[model samples]
Target: MLAKRALSIAGGLAVLGWPFAVWLALTYPELHILLPILALCFVLRLCALRGKTGALSRAFKGLALAGAVLCIASIWMREAQLLLWYPVVVNAVMLTLFGSSLFSRMTIVERLARWREGELPPEGVRYTRKVTQIWCFFFLFNGSVSLFTCLAGNIHWWTLWNGMVSYLLMGLLFACEWLVRQRVRRRYE
Candidate 1:
């Protein structure tokens, strides 16, 4: 159990630190050295998901597989440029996960809210759906920008946008959503 938890934490950290990892791999031009480590991280993450069951779990597993594949491809092709696409792929996977949930009985945000609040009133349900839509929009926009960074062929620019700016934007969005959610909750109360 402890080993499983450690693998999960390592995998999560790998995913979160991907941008910096890519930046290091690219700046040093030693992709062969780093790609295998990344692939291993993804594999560890995949292994950690072994007993989980759910669409979300499957989606995350798929993401880990994709990341591993990309790393392997970068290594095979001896191309550091391929590593830049990892962020774009991350955004695309996120968009798919969040966007697909919109058509389900409950949006992803709604499920998370329900989990926390025990059950949502009608107004809360509506708010959660809207929040989910906002997240879909964010993923789409962020993915596009990530793709642009890959195409721009500027390592510093890519690192700046994917590594730093995108995170800041995500945090800002989360902060704004929390503030709005508090107001909505008060209004409904």
Candidate 2:
């Protein structure tokens, strides 16, 4: 498990590097293939880390594939400076908001899932719920503001669009999970 998690982290770092690599090699047209290939590796590694066996993973299969495609397709639209700054800004914001949570190993929502699955004892549930609320508010507030500012466009319109997509993606996944949980709860109740 530790090895799997470590590799996932390593793969994620490499994936994160793709944008910069794209930007750096922009003057060298032959290297255009690198970004998409890196994205493919990330998607593959993420799939491997997921074990390709869970129902949720299967349900999100299309989305995962689409994200990979989008990453590659989006790169085709980006040039040097903008491409490099894209993930740098987004991830920096995410990291600033969730640094402590990252330090704790699992994200707040991850722990919440553990509790929901009965993997966590009752004592941890309260903290998990509180942390989840904090993180969600951060996502909603800072994220929405970022999206709006992007729309106002002192920056590239693409960044704004990217922020909107991020918001939509998270919202879609949350809604899907909530719907599924609601159905399961109704069945049990």
* lDDT digits (tens) for residues 78-127 of candidate 2: 64333434433443445444554545666555554785675654444444
Estimate the lDDT of model 1.
0.87
Model 1 vs. true fold: TM: 0.94
Q: Write the per-residue lDDT of candidate 1 for residues 93-175, one digit (tens) a residue.
A: 88888899988999888888877889889998899889988999999999999898888899888989988999999999999
Q: What would the TM-score be for candidate 2 when compared with the true structure?
A: 0.43
Task: Point to the candidate with the largest TM-score.
Answer: 1
Pairs of colliding residues, candidate 1: none
The reply for model 1, stretches above 4 Å from the true place, is none
